[model samples]
Target: MLSIKNLTKIYGGKNKAVDDISLDIEQGEFIAFIGTSGSGKTTALRMINRMIEPTSGSIEIDGKDVMQMNPVELRRSIGYVIQQIGLLPHLTIKENIVLVPKLLKWSEERKDKKARELINLVDLPESYLDRYPNELSGGQQQRIGVIRALAAEQDIILMDEPFGALDPITRDTLQDLVKVLQKKLGKTFIFVTHDMDEAIKLADRIAILSNGQLIQFDTPDEILRNPANQFVRDFIGENRLIQDRPNMRTVEDAMIKPISVTADKSLSEVISIMRERRVDTIFVTRNDGTLLGYLDIEDINEGYRKGKDLVDIMHRDLFKIQIHDKLQDSVRTILKRNLRNIPVVDENNILLGLITRSNLVDIVYDSIWGETPAGVDEA
Candidate 1:
């Protein structure tokens, strides 16, 4: 458990960057600190590892005072990720990830094994471990930075706007990845961000700060449903208050049956089904209704002569959404990625349905224009 009691930071003489803030974080909880610029979110976070000393109060990790511990040892015991990534350009990806382990004097064999495991955790190829950090893209390098923080298996991870620099798609992907890693590894995370959507999406609880004071700290749903005051409501923005909008709340509300076929189907049969449905793409499912992949008209045009069945030419690099995801969370992805439609699956990856661009338009239209008037009829 991590406890902060009356944590306060005053710069120079009288500037209170973090004023009388207090919160308790449970083991393995994902917490986010968010506020406007100069609101002291970053200051409060930096205070956790003694990057910035507090002017008053205390921070205890598992009942031990962090301030009393050696600063170097305290920092090395905590995982930290930042916006700049801070990967050394001269080191290989493997070497970078295992730096902490090496400092801790872990054996070479154990370090190598740990490096490979972390690389796989981020869904990167093991071959990239030998490559230099400069060889990876921005997003890939960020992934390395994330795993490097975890390389030493620290109990608590502090991330300061780690995904803020990436494009929307990459940021979204990394958010999902980090959340999954946090849950799977059972690591405590204290993330600082300015994005409410990101905070709600990733945090078990959010700490909204303002003017060097803690405004509200609670679960995302609780904060959205019952904002503490006008400041919080304004901070959250009106558009995200989807509770009042009843027409389309979740992806499941708008999903329509996808045009799909079993993976055993022949090329001619799959093509005929697409022609009948007037869709350029057709999903391929297994006998158990698991999403195998999809085949598009272009794939057929290029590989029909050599392919044996739908699985032969199907593309598995598919983007998808869960059935229970909020519509608001998915809207930006659909529009920004310019996708015609995205598959909706259940927890088990079973093909539930699909949400198309048309469905999204109708949802947005209804949210703005509302349902048809009583006794009204269309021409």
Candidate 2:
């Protein structure tokens, strides 16, 4: 557990990055710090680890004041990760990943075992152990950085926009990875980011900061449904407009009607349909009403270059929530599948309607801010 009492960080005469903030972070809690630029979220985090010495107040980690501990020892016990990743170029992937453990004087056998475990934990191949940092992609390097922080087996991890540099797909993957890792390790996490979506998706509890002050701290649903003020509302963005939408509504409520696409369709064919219809995804079905897979532009391009079949490229491991399934169930499918759109299918695999991520968010917003549209009511 960690506790902050009257935490304040001031720069010279006028810059106060954190202003008299107090918070208690329980063990195994995934807490996110969110705010716009100059909000002092990062400052508050840094002060906890003595990365940035606080101007006043005190921070206690597991009951002892962090300021009273040696900075080097304190840092070793707390994992730190930043947006830049900061992997050592001279080191091999395994070496880079094992840096912290090595610093802690872990045995060679222990180090090797830990390295392999972390590599697999982050979904990297064991073959990457011998590879240099430069030989890996940005996402791979970021994974290595995460493994390195985790190498020492620290109880608390301080991450500042750890996934900010990766692409959207990689970002989502890593977010899922972090969620899994947190459950496995049961360690406390203090994460800072400007991205509200990421905060909401990953956080067990979110702490909103504005102009160096703590504005609100609560669960994602609470924050989304009942924003503390206009500042928090605007900060959450237009997505908040639909926080109250019915979760009971099905894809039938928002899906585009008329089944589309063929099993033998080529990437080019799917692309043409997407462009012509101004749609990003289409459902694939067989002649006898069997649902095959869903095709999106990205799926087409990835499969096209390999000369793969549409069915082969299609994600067959599709998760479907019925028309009457709870809205939370649909949202879960979207998050778990990392999908932007999901097909609402009946028991017979009948293609009903589609529910895009935007539509789901809109439903939530409409439930809160406006009347449910006539179409949804009918569906």
Highest TM-score scorer: 1
* Residue 183 of model 2, lDDT score: 82
Tens-digit lDDT track of model 1 for 1-379: 9999999998889999999999999999999999999999999999999999999999999999999999988988999999999998999999999998988999999999999999999999999999998899999999999999999999999999999999898998899899999999999999999998899889999999999999999998788888999999999988777533632378888889999899888889888889999999889999899998888899997778775566777899889999898777687677778988699999999999999899887777576556667443352
Give the lDDT of residue 317 in candidate 1. Answer: 84
Evaluate model 1: give its lDDT. 0.90
In model 1, pairs of residues that clash are: none
lDDT of each: 0.90, 0.82
RMSD of 2: 6.7
Q: Give the TM-score of candidate 2.
A: 0.75
Candidate 1 weakest lDDT stretch, 10 residues = 240-249
- Compute the lDDT for candidate 2: 0.82
Estimate, for each residue in 183-203, the C-alpha lDDT of model 2 and write its tens digit.
Answer: 899999889999887887689
Task: For each of the candidates, give the backbone clash count.
Answer: 0, 11
